[model samples]
Target chain A: MEQPHGPQQQRPPSSPPVPPAAGGPAAAAADAPHAAPRAPRRLSRRRLLKLGGLVAAAGGLGLYRCGLYDERLLPPGLRVLGRREAAIAAAVIETVLPPEPPPSPERVRTLLAAIDAYLLGLPAEQVEQLRWLLLGVEHGTFWFGARLERFTRLGARGRTDVLTGWQRSRLGLARAGLRGLVALVFLAHYRDAPAFAAIGYGGPLAPGFAGPPASAARYARLLAPPEREPGW
Target chain B: MIYTAEHVRRDRVLQADLCVIGSGAGGAPVAWEAARHGLRVVVLEAGSYLEPRHFTQIEYDMVQRLYHDGAARTTADRAIHVLQGKGVGGSTLHNLNLCKRLPEEIAAQWFADHGLAPLQGGTLPALFAELEQLLGVSELGPAQANANNRVLERGCRALGWRGGWLRHNRRGCVGAGFCELGCPFDAKQNALKVFIAEAVEAGALVLADTWAERLEHDRRRVRAVEAAVRDPRTGAVRHRVRIEARAVCAAASATGTPALLLRSAVPDPYRLVGSRLFLHPGTAVAGIFAEPIHGWRGIPQSYECTEWLDLGPQSTRRVWIVPSFAHPAGAAATLGAFGAEHARLMRDYAHMAALSPMVHDLVPGRVRPRGRFGVAIEYRLDPSDAAQLRLGLVAAARLLFAAGARRVLVPASPALELAREDEIEPVLGALSLRPHTLDLTSVHPMSGCWMGDDPARACCEATGRYHHLDNLWVADTSLFPGSLGVPPQLTTYALGLHVGRCLLAALG
Candidate 1:
């Protein structure tokens, strides 16, 4: 049976055979007639300097094209989603699953940028699908939030009845929207949060709820209202 | 003994009837049994003793300090992750404290086909009793389970998967969710906490920060073992030492043992050495729930589903869904590109539950020796194994959806998210099992330097003695000739105990 490809195949050959020298007896006699005339060597400091400058300029341009520089390289649609939609999504996610003391503005911005970068890197088809999914979520959350506010505005008995009714039909939709919203927010915030801690993940990776200022309670207050707010 | 004023000098040489190479699970119990029988015993360990205080909750640092290859070792062809631990306790130090014994059929096959004595009903029961008493293995109680494990239990029950609480070698665990990192509390009962400690207390000298380089022999009988001592942090060579032994036991795991033998040029013409390797590639399916599951607050993998074990030969599949957690770097790597969307996912961490299916792989691989003492493994899932992976993915997705998952993320390349429960099967069917598309990993790698009934197809005999060498023996998982269809640590330890006894009797 053929062996699976592994390190032995990937490593470069230990040693290559030495090539015959150009001026050896065999080469000199056999190719004497056809050998081209040797070119004269000259030192041109100005030319050398010009060549170095050109190489440096090319290298800088190459780095810029690789998305290493500050300016955005993605298409306008993607750039807009990264810059604007990401922030809005993060804010909305904070409201949906609020952490205590809420994330700082810088933290939220970092989160948005990370998520935007992540989404932008995806295949065009996936990005399109995700965009549609997010749009659906945005619409659902908007309606759900409006309905919730409307019900809260009613008298206590009225609020209770309306909530009980919505629980039957719209609860599933509301839950789905909340999940989408939370996922988007987490993907965004996790990029900026400490490497050990995560919002929704509790695998071997979660840093757990410890450390100094980044208390879970503080994060909750920052993201959502105190009562009935989701805390991760 | 070489000594100066700082070290006591003795011109005397103390000898043992049998000298085991490692003091981990495979070597520890054997040494204990041998020593208990009034045999002079010396157990050599390559790693130092790590106190409970040394165990940290830091992912990067702990993995570097505790895990072999610093947790970056992977198969070359596909990014199949591999993890092993190095230290006084071996892999038990870093493992998730899961214990499982091989099924009766598998044990019987070993006996019938390999000429090893059959581990019959009573024999296996006695072995289990000895193992349980020695390792303190027990099932996790409901009160000891965390919310995440409970969610797994609920999911398995909802899907009617044959699942049950997993037995772990732990005591007084506080649900720290840092088993992979190294439990901060001295709750995990790795070899260091139990066997190695007892061995040391019983006058076994363990040389830490040492590597057994090669085996030296006179004709067929082994004479001495050569090793090097170095600084653990810098890896700078400190000293070279040699221990003359009457016999040497190689318990260096499946990968390490064969590589060591190959490097030493101890000829076994069967070409079966370092072949027939099995890695149970596993993957996790993450589900987003409506409520906080607090997955990190409980036993890492308290419950498991054995529903798929008897899926039959044609199916070539087995799956168990267990609770799992991820550290930040691991989470970030899995989360892919980071930013606002990723951040949002992080915020809802409490509402997430990850279910992993550990599959039984039939496809075999090989481990080749490389540079100095290093090993390179090559493995590829065969067609049947690939089919099993698809089945496993479908099963995992169905269970997650049944457990009230609003959305589930599949770890396939171009990762897809399942929104509705109905989309699970179709999406799973569409997945490509090509190396690039799948995220595969294995914690249990076995059957490399395997034993067989005949000299033509095997590296060693039933007693783990190399066919060509009278005094050389293997006491590690490498001696397993085939897949056990379950975790092999307990079985490895039992085999070690059996072989150690046989070697002593033969010597006498």
Candidate 2:
């Protein structure tokens, strides 16, 4: 394969190993480059995240002139998640919750809007990390063996399998990405009253509640307004 | 006169007898007392004034309005998410009202070890009682224990654990479950409603969306507090206000208090300005029960199990187990699964019940400012604290099954769901205690400016006055010598009142 083109892009070994996401140190050992055993204590999630960052940044090398800065290519009104990233999100969320009744088009738009809002709310560095996560997952199809697969090329079944692989993949980076995206989708869907009602939760009881709602008047006598000072 | 910075059109200077910074649980009581005691008080709050009208009760909107960093703040390395309140009322605006006096032994330890005289037996209890009365502290009624809490309550009973209704600082809380989302019902009696109202009523001035830049101080005392009046929404400084006060009380929380002092170049002779910072980091296990639990429906944190609340100075630390429900935003953020499995778990959202297991920290942490843009908290899990969490999680999982949960979803990174009760022990035992393996979060951040008699040992003195400056006092959770296994709002209120009384005495 042509040596990946970028400052930090280097071809990882032919076989990219997979480790279980749980069982902390034991799982992290799978990601180590060499067979030589090292203390798992020294291998931290922060360090692993940093490594993932490097890999993701490198993955975006030839994807676009500026993979992230290429905003003109995106469908209008979409800020952070462009056509490619948004498609990946749509695919991933659908696969995560493939119910008999798939979410409506409006529901999908709402979820994506929530995600965009969340991404916008992120600190600048985190925003880069999330964007990189999206790009890396997409680029994995091309860079990693055909078995690893790209997001666009994968069928619905293939997409689900890839996500499952990531979730179950001993790589902490893949796990973090999957977890974060899942959160964005789940929260956006479930934060509303209909979501609560579907789950059988009676919504927050307030104005109709029998007890005296916390009123400042309760302590009016004790904390009555003090005599105002003469205009100084 | 009270000024909302949203209306600040130009720069202005204000003067007062005392200046209290950050109107949270720590500052409000002091402001209330100061103004009530005939002192001209000026309060500067960095966040906006989120009243019930402003509180939309929507998760996303509420977080943007109430939470510091918009509920997205994480620890320095992004290991643990930190949830703190912002706006005029500070954290009190949105805190789940689980009120507890500082655990007696922790207070006693401070009194004995650090010579925190005011924290001795009756001193704190009296203050606690006074504040409790004023704040309307009461236990959750049977009606208030919704299905989610009922799960925890029943589970504790099944396990023969000592757990029951939690006392909250609320009055007429009509089970408005969105307590963490800034109670739109105006049910939660936070400082924003009680003390702040009293503070304003009693001839005190509260500058909303105003940030204190520096304590203009010299070797002897703080001369004036220089602040910026900014647009609450944009945080763009629209005006400047310099308040000259006889004394200053820093209640800017554990993070903000130290940051302010460091920014102002205040005296730290003992190098103890930002040391001993503590966040009682918590992780919860969610259970999907057969019945619709609707975890987010009622009072969020109205029940706790004290079966394992071991406060003794022993090898094992105390673990406080409680049902901690979340608004969809926070809940979604911590979910460990992705794809169908993620949807599968969330699909049972009405059936999801969660338990937050927390521990008192032995490993003292510190907070450091990263220039002016942000602050980084340095917290490493003490080995025992980690063990306590593991044990607590196990206990919680077992209790869930005992309460008849179909399955339990832990906060584990790779997604751990105990589908069968039999798998609980084996699965829990297999896990190791790495920092990132769990979804770690902290709602309580305590003890950045510890109070003690020894100038060389602690940051603040017995009366909550800073050892370095004569006119500077601290009346916040920053003064706690250590983490309280329970919620610190009540203790925060009591401590603020205690320090306010002391400062009043000194000033007189």
Candidate 3:
């Protein structure tokens, strides 16, 4: 039914080269529309194992990372995070979304509560991935594989450094988890009023209307349902 | 009467002259026209009737309620993020209300490739004009163009490119900027307001929270559409509803329509039923401005720069530079930055002006039906399409600089943060097509179930009738032969009208 050879696919037309601007790589890239496909950045299966293999090593040491979050300590809305997991999440988000004015204890509680609610509701697969990401972030190390210090144990600056390192890590798994957590935590914070206002966002399309909806009354003609024939 | 499946205590059997699946742009129009003609019509909508007053414009809430899988709909590989809408109004409820007719070249492509005679022969323009009048397609005025949109226009002027206001199906749009979320002010003339409302007024029975499992069809025609009435809050189905109809039109969407066909076990003679799908994968490059653009305050996507939008056959200049102002959750989802930089990006969310420089993609994809009421979309931005996005980012970065942006965040392979205007090219030029590097998001998903004269190459006829299944028709963007390089709401409406007319003729 199909041919494996020849120009079987219809390729998009090449654009007339964008007139180049002055600048080195960026300028050259300004005209960089159609380039040969480059190889995807990937860590081999061995590299991924190298990144996450630290959890088993910790298990060998009998340092249980499971149930790190305390359900009772979390705000009423939250059910998933244990005390330790909640603390580390709060710490991680503090670095990711550093609030401008120092937050009240209540403010911090609300943001964390919102995050807990979001995490608790994630679909089964995403929850698994989030948990895995949290474990890696909270436990993975700079030394070898995800086997570094517990993230909460690291200083504020150290936490930032560790997250950056993971972002820059060759292992795609580490990067995926890192990005996923950033999005989840980032959105969770923005959903809170204090955090939302900090970013200069106002919820709801401000009810600034010029007038009520006006139909051209295009269907006014069809209102009478004429007895005219529709046959062609 | 609108029936929610959850409260239906018994299996209900309903009948209509025409049964339309999905109540978005496609199904709503057909249902309206048929019901207007005094035909008994039944419309089945899987999503709930999320009315305007209930449209809490909060990004998180809207995504959970309106978007498919809470806007977490993705390709099978979880690479590209799909942004299809759900609910009685379908995606139109959350869509930005861009109502462009099929571009002339794309119309010709359909005629030549798919033998769509109606798209030619002066048929399409008349229908397009009809839709325009009905939907209130207006050229956005200067007042409606928000600061986010002005930034793109300013850049286009600075670069001497053809850029201006886009026409939208809005009546008194007060620039609420939450177009991705449902418009609370009822300013958007989505099908819920226009076609579906009219259809309901004309006595079309609309069933919400009812999921059509499959079409009961023989080799020649669909017998009855079997659906489950469901609780809007819970997935529990309380009753079953069977709608026996003279004709069935699948307008569920580019993804849902084909899935319905496959679920019905409809014969695919050409083996092209759910193949060769096209979605315009877009990537937004954010620019931090010194001035408080407050990009979220006004109408999102009012202006566009079409300088490099070349959609001719085999042409690579396939990019549309459009304004993209995002609500918090929407903005954070496809943001390419991670870690502290992502946090910093959010910090400047107020000053962030983004341009969704999207690519006109041609690489085809597939939509596979998964678990009950679930579908898996598989699409990839091939190297060429990825290359198109790379150039789009370059143009966007320059536009930001021209618009007096302090810094631009380029979501490139080696994502660049350029402060100086001169850094746009070298930084981008140095980057290669790390194929999976782009944060691809698409609102326009088109061309899965194609229409053509040939039975082998195309799935259905230009008349919108399924070739193998006689009485089943398609009335959605899925019938499109290729990408239209523009917002497709108007085209979808006209296609629905065309199909409805054809069906009327066939029934007579």
All candidates: TM-score: 0.70, 0.82, 0.83
For residues B1-508, could you state the per-residue lDDT of candidate 1 as single tens digits?
A: 1011112122223356666777667777767666666666655555544555556465544655565554545665534767767776787777888888767767767766787653445766688778877788998867887767777777778977777888888877777777876665667777666766655455555555566777777548877777666555544446665667777788877888888787777767767778778888877778888988777666778887677776344445466557666655554445432334345555656777887777777778899776654578898777787787788788877878888889988765334789988898888897777664555678888888777768888887777788878888888888887777777778887878777777777777
Interface RMSD of each: 19.9, 6.0, 8.6
Q: For residues B382-414, what per-residue lDDT tens digits would candidate 3 score against the true structure?
A: 888888888898999999999899999866422
Highest TM-score among the candidates is held by which one?
A: 3
lDDT of 2 by residue, A36-84 (tens): 5433356589999999988887786545322443222223466677676
| lDDT at position A73, candidate 2 | 23
Poorest 10 consecutive residues by lDDT, candidate 2 chain B:
B1-10
- Candidate 1, residue B374: lDDT: 57
Please state the CAPRI-style docking class of candidate 2: incorrect
On DockQ, the stronger of 1 and 2 is 2
- Candidate 3 residue runs with Cα over 4 Å from true position: A1-60, A67-73, A77-95, A99-147, A150-162, A171-177, A205-232, B5-7, B234-238, B336-343, B412-415
Whole-model Cα lDDT per candidate? 0.63, 0.75, 0.75
Superposition error at A122 for model 3 (Å): 6.5
lDDT for B210 in candidate 3 is 80
